[model samples]
Target chain A: MKKIVVSLLLSLSLLGLGNAWAVDSLNISLAPEQANPPSPQMGDWLKFHSVIENSGSQAAHGVVAWISLVQVDPGHEQPVDLEDWSAHKAVTQAILQPGQQVKVEWPMRLIQAGAYRVVISAVDRETGHVMTSPFVDFQVRRKPVVDSGRILPVALGVPMLVLGMMAWRRYRRRTGV
Target chain B: MNPITLIARKEAGELLMSGRGLAWLLALSVIMSVLSLLLVSNTELSLLDNAQVVYMVMGTVTALGALLAVVLGSDAVAGERERGSLMPLLLAPVTPSQIVFGKMGGQVAGWVVMYLLSLPYVWAVGSSGQNLTQAVAYLALFGTPVVLGFGFLGIALSARLRSVRSALLTSLITLMLLASPLLLGPSLRQSAIGKLFDAVNPFSAAVNSFDSVVIDSQPLAMQINRLAISLVWLVLTAVFAIRSVRKMEI
Candidate 1:
């Protein structure tokens, strides 16, 4: 009985030490609201919801979370201007507790259609440490080319005729023909 | 026909047959064809692409129209004086105002040719596209006055100068000076002088108006300040041109 009790006490103390030694860290995840409309089109307003989790034992204060649209270029990624992209409601969570999470939303308008990556970054004010989430691949497609198929020829032809007549009149006058 | 219309028709015929007219037409055609092909060949379409193309077309057309005005009106009186034809023209039944109006009309005809040349390209990019009609309408509305204003200024400078070469040079220089406000950097553009220049300059006003209407998708009513400024400039320039014509010798 004594041996069994000592064994149990040792295991419990070790578990407590392990729990006490746990480090503080922040985690973030971003997700789009709907499965449908998976890809955003130009001029479409998209909502990105991000969950910021404090995976550590302590509370995090002045935790700022921001979402950014980035274009992956050769050898580097360029940040798209939020102003030009029509981003709105970029949110921040002031306080997050241990094992607690807060949700933030970024409502952005897809102004220019192209391939991009959505990135969410959280900065802990106390530690001045910044944590970034994995890139969310995205593509914006252009609206289909407007078929003005029949109108194209007429549009071109009428102008050509007008220009030709003007030129011909000038030619006749110049040559006195 | 009105005296202005008759004189305008005669002058337009002369311009169309001239070497410069053919050159401008050829250049303009090539530009429009290339731009249209590029715009249509693209598989994906967006409002920005259409707006950008429209903006490019507007800028190119306006600059070219201004060039035509300078080329055609710069010699309205000075070149005639140099060639000893001013006396006969001034002695004709048309008054000085009529002559000015006639020459202005001829420049306007050139502008019409440019506008027509750009229509197909504009249509290809803008038809059925958002803000296309507004872009085209703004181009026409503000574009007409811009061309007319530049033509009047060119004719005024030509009337004031004695030599064709001198008049042409002076008019071109003045155009460059007017466009300087647009070339300034962002920091400088916000300065007092920059603000003053942009407020009074017709070209800048028109370009800003285009931005507001097309890119911002603002209605025409929102562009009253810019439109008003351009109109004021147009009137001032026209008045200056008329006064110069009246005071012109020979």
Candidate 2:
């Protein structure tokens, strides 16, 4: 009677653990999730491109995106809370459907001029699956602006200005400037 | 003949005889047409392109018309005053209002002629993009007045200075001074300063017209604000120019 009770209890525990959950019928791939050698100019606008693909047999829905700025080489993650950068959770629209690949544009200006790494990935908001892209690397250095040779417009504009002034002054003088 | 119509014909006829004026007018249309074609083609590649191309071309045309109007308008009264030809016109039977109407008509006609020449490119942009008919109609109707308004404003300023050279320079200088305020401006329709700039700036008004017609695909009725603003400028310019002409001392 003691053995029978013990066996019955053990059987119930095993039955509970035996129930199965279904496997995901979708696959996701990310393209160039990292950007290297980013623009070094201070206050310069930056845009990086990421492409997403649904490789699985089943269509995926409710895709979500995640991007983080990280230190390169050592790979420390999520240094910048991009949500704080914008007043919204995501500056971009949130939802994407499966088997419908779309490009994601990630734009961020460097807060400090130095080396940095960006990691990007996506998952279905409904199903928790991560899609990671190839890593891209970027470096920050001094970007030249108005440091060398005269810009064409100003260079060209000077001559035009001279002529215009001369012509204008003459015109004004004749008719009383 | 109506006083306005007579003046328009006479001024347009005078401009026709001017080789430099004709050349500039043709060049402006060609450059604008080519630019319109390039811009339209570029926008055709995108789904969200707006009526900016037409805005740009019209802005250029209106700016030119305004500058020309000032240069020519100053020449109309100030030149006559300087050359001492204004006295005879003052002695003539026409009233200040009639003279104003005539001068306004002529200036308006000059702009209309230049606008008509750029139809091919203008229409092409419309046909290629959205709202081709609406764009053309807007340009034909409101655009003419916008052009006239700019011209008249330049002339009005010219009249006040009593010197063609001073009037032209003042108008051009005013135009140059405007660039900073426009770029730094926020909310052309919302802010008082921005609205004031739009009210005074013919180029801005013309650009607004294009945006309404081509980009927004809006009807002529919707553009009344811009048209009305432009007409007010035109009337003001006419009133001042006519007064200056009638009060001629040469």
Top candidate by lDDT: 1
lDDT of 2 by residue, A1-177 (tens): 999999999898775543210023323233332443334543343556776655555455566666666655345433654532222223233444445566666766443334566666666544444555656566655332211122233323433543464466557668985
- Per-candidate TM equals 0.70, 0.53
* Candidate 1 residue A48 C-alpha distance from true site, Å: 4.5
CA lDDT of each prediction against the hidden true structure? 0.73, 0.56
Superposed on all Cα atoms, model 2 deviates from the true structure by an RMSD in Å of: 12.9
> Model 2 clash pairs?
A34-A136, A35-A136, A36-A137, A36-A138, A37-A137, A37-A138, A60-A98, B51-B215
Summing lDDT over every window of 10 consecutive residues in candidate 2 chain B, give the lowest-scoring window: B42-51
Please give the RMSD to the true structure for each candidate, in Å.
6.7, 12.9
Structure candidate 1, residue pairs in collision: none
Tens digits of per-residue lDDT for model 1, A24-62: 467788887684277667767777778888987778778
Q: What's the lDDT for candidate 1?
A: 0.73
Candidate 1 chain B worst ten-residue window by lDDT:
B178-187
In Å, residue A35's CA in model 1 sits off its true spot by: 11
lDDT of 1 at B101: 83
Query: After TM-score superposition, what is the CA distance of residue A95 in candidate 1 from its true location, in Å?
Result: 10
Looking at model 1, give its docking quality level.
Answer: incorrect
